[model samples]
Target chain A: MVLLEFSMSPLGKGESVSKYVSRSLDIIDKSGVDYRLNPMGTVLEGEWDEVMAVVKKCYMRMRKDCNRVSCSIKIDYRKGPKGRLSSKVSSVESQLKRKLKV
Target chain B: MVLLEFSMSPLGKGESVSKYVSRSLDIIDKSGVDYRLNPMGTVLEGEWDEVMAVVKKCYMRMRKDCNRVSCSIKIDYRKGPKGRLSSKVSSVESQLKRKLKV
Candidate 1:
């Protein structure tokens, strides 16, 4: 499975870009990829096509309304099973042996 | 100031939930606030009202199309100036003095 972490926002969109970010997310929603929203970016878990396609669509959609868009992406592609979404966090928590406070 | 990290999704969606998540993000975008998109959840930086307002809107908007929605939220409220977004991460990086790979 491929795990992708990414943030996309339009440049010169003022102090807050939640509105534009929301539109980009619409594209991701229609792409049919499993995703978890995070504090920094959204984590997408799927095959290469499913994950990259969503990222590509988000960038494309943002371009229509905003002149410049900034995207930060980090991808972890593994040739193994799925369900790493929760498992990865669980593993880290297990090592700490304490529930994450937040 | 207030910092919020959250994930919102519709229950009973298939394995992939990009679409629903995207819709939720739309509400967040319209909210006039500062935010960062992360791998686990989107982080919003603002006063209590601004931050929570966005969360409230996202939850409300998502309920329109999704029968059941799940949300995870974490907040860090501090009495200080703005700009914790990069500073928080930068502080950690400074401690290690090693650049984050991704």
Candidate 2:
């Protein structure tokens, strides 16, 4: 399984961007993928192709209206394991003996 | 200051991608931006334009040879303060009362 976390935004869209972010979230919600949104970015877990397709769709959606789009993605590809979205943090928290500020 | 963590790789380049990663790192290093390389991605701390320019350079370089390229970027834009690349982790470490496995 692969855990992909990404953030995409359009440049020159002014300081407030919740409108654009909301649009992207709508696409992600409709994709039916397991995802968790954090302050920095959204984490999605699934097959590589499915996950990437979602990102591609979101980028396309953003690109349609904006001239310059900026996207940042981070992928953690691991074999034989799934659900690293929470597990990874739990593992670290277990060592730290407390909950982390997510 | 903005803290940008990004990972870029060329798809269909087989498993080991140290060569491409090294090339991108060379560009980032030459850009003279303060950055730290971790297992997941590289965190760069600098002005928004400067940091993003480095990422653009890396993406363009990867696009030169590879037909398909994948990049993930997470950005934290804060009004004031620098050195978040280490200080962010250090803040958590301080609360955890120990060093983290960076």
The residue-by-residue lDDT of candidate 1 on A11-98, one tens digit each, is: 8988666566556555665567877654355688999888888898888888887898887776666678998777665443455454
The best candidate in terms of TM-score: 2
Q: In candidate 1 chain B, where is summed lDDT lowest over 10 consecutive residues?
A: B93-102
lDDT (10s digit) by residue, model 1, range B2-98 = 8887778788876556666555555555566766654456688898888887888888878877899888776667678998777664443455544
List DockQ for all candidates. Answer: 0.06, 0.05
Taken over the whole model, the C-alpha lDDT of each candidate is 0.69, 0.74
Give candidate 2's iRMS in Å, 1 decimal.
11.3
Model 2 chain A: lowest-lDDT 10 consecutive positions:
A93-102
**Model 2 stretches with alpha carbons more than 4 Å out:** B1-75, B78-102
Supply the TM-score for candidate 1.
0.52
True contacts reproduced, candidate 2: 0.00
